[model samples]
Target: MNTTPFRAGHVAVIGRPNVGKSTLTNALVGAHVAIVSPRPQTTRHRLIGIASYSEGQIVMVDTPGLHRDFGSANATAMHKWMNKAARGALDGVDAALLVVRAGQWEEADEYAYQALQRESLPVMLVINQVDRIVDKDQLLPYVAEVTKDREFAAVALISALKRKGLKELTRDILKLLPEQEAIYPEDEITDKSQRFLAAEMVREQVMRQLGEELPYATTVEIESFEVDGTMLRIGAVIWVERNGQKAIVIGKGGERLRDIGTQARLQMERLFGTKVFLQTWVRVREGWSGDERALRAFGYHD
Candidate 1:
């Protein structure tokens, strides 16, 4: 089975919360395959982003951040799922890209280092958010610290938001990839379906417009999706932890909620390439964060 063109396999991009893992995955794939926001754990599921070059294809797995200290059942499950996605889903990956924030290492870095050590996998150390640093020389010490581990194949600095050093990094990654056949069909963009992306897009909108407090306590689920010729009819529910937050999301006279709906509709229209009829409702799911059943209903595992 010469899967040469199928240069298709999983490559996991992992790091602590808000380290630009999602940003990098989106940048590499040249699309918004994974949702991005300032909030931690914005990415709760493992998303596959495909980046195809004339020579090969790289399917990158963007997992949720590893929250080492979360003790709640839901948080623990999330953390375990993240590690499982990396180890199990990306087991035979040609290589791993370990993303770290630039400037200095922290306790999280130590944990990441130890995790990489156990895998015995070749790692590419990426110092993300270099655009935040003014002096190029300042990044050298960080590079030096990472290269101290002989397990690293190469080190590169990048700003995922600005798309810097991505080309070179992709080239290096492709070089290390095995000569396998493409794992996906040529036009396939992600492992998730349009329904999932629609839910995520709405969630991203909620996070972006509703601000931090409400966003973290919120989850969106698409209850129904129907495509009829020239338009898409979507029924969605937005879950908030409390009654007051529900009022806030729905807004005064439903103004804010309407605005959110308008924004989401436009994006969905563009994504689906058709007219979108989006209807939203709010629900009060007390302590939804701790509710295993609620999480599962919203597509997170128990």
Candidate 2:
């Protein structure tokens, strides 16, 4: 018979842009609840990923990257909203994991550390992308330098992409949580709806396929999501800021749009565990990312 109590609580995965916060969240939850791309600021909302174990469960709050440029003159309404979403995730979280690249710590990293310190919560320094480092011997000294002036409850060197050192990280995180029943059911993986996930699936492909050609002003809106038998029929509108951008997304003879839909549909099928019939269309919404009203219409509200 098992005598240990089950522990569960929310842990905020906080970090700068493109530091593998979403990757870590997905790895821990054992599902792709949060979308991922190589682009910075890929995550714009606060998502809850539930990771369940026999002894405990972790309700991970995957938030947008905490960036400093939101207050700048060039910052858009979406930028401010992203920063707001990131900061808001800290509320009511039992602990935080400050994720950063293995061999790099910059001013942005220090800013994130300061924000977490202000909350007075137990913070664990997660050095991600350690698999990219060629010199493993320098890891110890790098960790020491980062932790010299800052107070961290624990430090973990992990490769969220390769799924290395996550077991120990989970164990340390569970220690910070209170002893209680699971916050969510074991089978549940995320707190988002199928419709929302569907939109994100399309956006992920857009970000991945377009790369630098795609502007940050781009977004996706689910026009329709209906279930027919065991299959899901999803329609998404890819919104760009200009007609030229729309042309770029559609590509010559609409081949790019077709590829995007095909890839996104395959992802939906894998995640939803059913056949997905997806339709995608590119439309222009002039400067929607900078317009507050447009942002709200596209589901960017706080």
Candidate 3:
């Protein structure tokens, strides 16, 4: 007879910008460890979400999208930092999931695939956003083109928005993890703290609500987090690169910021299971995204 414990190990989710990496992480872990937005580069930091099962566990690492740096004059410091963070997470991981949109493969996907090929580990090609595909037969050619020059342990067709084909993907992932004991408590959903999640919650609203108002220069930081009884109090700062961006975020009469706060606070209440009091402040940081010290202070790790 063969006896073995549950399997568990880190699996890094990698792909180009706006390819549903964060959505897949949330579905795999059954919790929101990373923020999702329609705009590209929604995830700026590396996040860990843990999922435990009777047979094994999967620790999912959601990283920023892979963006190449050619050392051109227009390459910002933040872009380099984010790309480094994503590629660095790939090393020393048990497995990787390369997510891509359902339709045809683009050059961005090729860039991400090239990055995954360098890792000497099992990589699963995740074809996401199938719900958007009108004709199912069209997927065949697309799949062939995507896998033509690449090698993958497995490929899964999934619609992260509709939550389809996730079970099969999970089953395949369970088999790839190393056989070992659980790395975290069974009930734990993620390795991140409530503070980091709260900050991300605020950032999500900013990205989703203000994608047009502020496309590329906005980040959130939690100034204070206090819990007492069934109530939680949090103060956050929204840093913008320019004063005009700050005004746009705050809006006339502070209406826009209030909307962002209301949405973020409601999500936090659901996640924490407590009434939340959240205060938000917007300020102009003037090139913080390009400043190394500011990026570190905002929790950007190499």
Candidate 4:
């Protein structure tokens, strides 16, 4: 057999909604491979997290959280459909990282716990948001409860916000990984393209600025992306459900659009390491969510 000191494999990070799973995946990958927000159901699909090391590489899959409803088309009618989509991300993972929030586990946690019970895969129970707990003693009990599950290879407490214990957690993940050839080239960090990433960064900025139902109802598509010398020219369409929403996004004299463009351009510049000129247009796409063709055209459903 061909021998290399370093090994690589996929580790799935699964948990309930809004449990800092995306943040932790970003921290572990050493870049913004996945988007993070305080909003639940922020992640819609399985995102890859790659960690490079001297001995091996760890590819972490940050999955959409297991929940009753994911605010998608199947949200109310067939929740099992959403659950199947969430669980599909866990298949064939070499290891699993279970992210649990500190303090009392909620009813949603049971869904996650039961899901884990069905898996024989090696798991690492991660206690996220440790900074929120004022007393260190209060943390131990929950950790104990998680360890009792017997599916866990180990239990860890960490604060994704404060970036505590992430190094050790990284080491633990590496240790649990099975010896396999690197699935991805060492230089490649993510599966998404530059244009897709730019669109996501803009969407994230819009979510932060607008908040509420706007974040849920809005979607961004990159109409065009081109680089000329040191400047990056980008065109994107922001789709909202109703005419009023479009008016709100555009604002008077296109003021809000300007705000969105400015924030997105700044972030994109930092990410691409070049100056960016971003142009955005707001369009009302009624029934876009239910229209499969519209979803495909916007690159939402693949």
Q: Predictions ranked by TM-score, top down? A: 2, 3, 1, 4
Q: Number of the top candidate by TM-score? A: 2
Put down candidate 1 lDDT per residue, 162-236, tens digits, no spaces. 999999988878766777778887677688988888888888888888766675788889999998888889988
lDDT of 3 by residue, 1-302 (tens): 53656789999998888899899989877877788999998898888888787778998988988866523457787887888788888877899999999985788788888888887889999999998999999999989988887899999999987899999998898888998888889999887899999999999999999997787799999999999778999999999999889999998999999999999999999888899999999988899989989898988765
- lDDT per residue (tens digit) for residues 79-183 in model 2: 999989999999999999999999999999998998898996999999999999999999999999999988999999999999999999999999999999998
Model 1 pairs in collision: 3-180, 3-181, 4-180, 4-181, 5-182, 6-181, 6-182, 7-181
Ranking by lDDT: 2, 3, 1, 4
Instruction: Kindly list the per-residue Cα lDDT of model 4 for residues 245-279, writing each as its tens digit.
Output: 99888889999888988988888887677999899
- List per-prediction Cα lDDT, in the order shown: 0.79, 0.93, 0.88, 0.78
- Which structure is stronger by TM-score: 1 or 3? 3
**Which has the better TM-score: candidate 2, or candidate 4?**
2
- What's the CA error at residue 120 for candidate 2, in Å? 2.3
Predicted model with the maximum lDDT: 2
- Pairs in steric clash, model 3: none
What's the CA error at residue 194 for candidate 3, in Å? 1.0
Please report, as a residue range, the 10-residue window in candidate 1 with the lowest summed lDDT: 70-79
Colliding pairs, model 4: 6-55
Model 2 pairs in collision: none
lDDT of 1: 0.79
